[model samples]
Target: MKNLLESPPDKLLTALRDILAAKSIVSPAEIAERIALTDAASPAQGARMVARAWTDPDYRALMLHDGAKAAEAAGIPMRGMPPLGVLADTPDLHHLVVCTLCSCYPRAVLGYPPFWFKSAAYRARAVRDPRGLLAEWGTVLPSHMKLTVVDSTADYRWMVLPLRPAGTEGFTEAQLAALVREGDMIGVTLPIASA
Candidate 1:
C-alpha cells in the first residue's frame, strides 16, 4: 500500500473526493465548484471589507462583532469554513496573527496563505517576538503601542483590519482598498498613503 503521508496533496485530495463521491456524501462537481470558488478568492476581498469598515461605522461594528457575516456581506462566501475573526488595529494597539501548529488562515477572504505565513520561523517569531517580526517586515509601530498576537486555529481563523492610513480621509472606498494589501490584512505590514 502506498503511504498516504507521502502522497502529494492533489492525489490525496482526489482520493478523498473519490471516496466521498462513492459514498454519495458530496458530488465531484460540488467539490470542483467549491475549489473554483476558493481559487477565485483573493486578498482583494479582505481589502474591500477593510476599506468598507474604515469608511462605514456600521460595517465596522459588524466586522468586529462577526467576521464571517462581514465577509458574506462583502460578497465573499464563508460557507463550510471555520469561523473568522477580525482584529481591528487601533492607534494604541496592534494585532499580529499566526497559526502555531499550521497555516490556519482566513482563506475564504484572503485566498491561499502566503508561503512565509506557513514558515516555522514566522510562526515562532510571531509568538515569541512579534515586534521583532514586524520590524523585519519593515512595520515599525510606535514604541508605546501594545502588540497582541492572536493564533488562528483550524476551528477559527483570523484576519487583521489595519488602521486606515493618514491622508485617506477623502479617498474613495476603491482608493482605500487599493492601499490595503495581503500583508496589511495579515498584520505584517500597514497600509501607507500614497503621496
Candidate 2:
C-alpha cells in the first residue's frame, strides 16, 4: 500500500474525494453545488447590493428588513443558508458586526472573513472597545454618532450597508460598487469617493 503521507496535498485530497464518491458517501455534483454556493457570497455581490440600495430606496428598505430575501432578489443564491441581517449606517448611528463565540460572518456577502476578524483579540475588543477598534482600523465616526456592535450568530448573520459617500451622485451602480470594499461592509472602514 502507498503511504498517504508521501502524496501531494492536492493528490491526497483528490484521492479521498474519489474514494468518498465511490463509496456513495458524497458525489461530485454535491461538492460542485457547495463550491458554487460558497462562491456566490463574495464581496462583489455585496457591493452590487449596496449599489442597488444606494440607487433604490425600496431595495434599501427591503435589505434592511430582510437581508436574505434581498440577497435572493439580487440573484444571490442563498438556499439553506442562515438568515441575514443588514445594518445601515445612518448619519447618527454606526453598526459593527462580530461573532463573539466564533467567526460567523456573512460569507454570502463578504466571502471569507479576514484573518484578523477571526482572531480572539478582535472578537473581544470589538465588543469591549468598539471605538478604539474602529480607530485602529482608521474608521473614526462622528462624536455624536452612536456605535452599535452586533454579534453574529449561527442562525443570523449580519452585513453592513454603509452610507453612500458624498460626491457619488452621478456615479452609476457599477461605479459605486467599485468603491465598496469588504472592509466597508464589515464596518471597519468607510468607502471613499474616488476623484
- The lDDT of model 2 is 0.91
Scored against the true structure, residue 114 in model 2 reaches a CA lDDT of 89
Model 2 stretches astray by more than 4 angstroms = 1-25
Candidate 2, residues 101-195, lDDT tens digits: the string is 99999888779898999999999999999999999998889899999999886689899999999999899999999999998998999999971
Best by lDDT: 1
Against the hidden true structure, what lDDT does model 1 obtain? Answer: 0.92
lDDT of 1 by residue, 1-195 (tens): 988899999989888989999999999899889989989889989999999999999999999999999999988898898898899999999999999899998999999999999999999999998988899999998999999999876688899999999889899999999889999998999999982
TM-score each candidate.
Answer: 0.90, 0.88
Spell out the clash pairs found in candidate 1.
none
Give lDDT: candidate 1, residue 189.
93
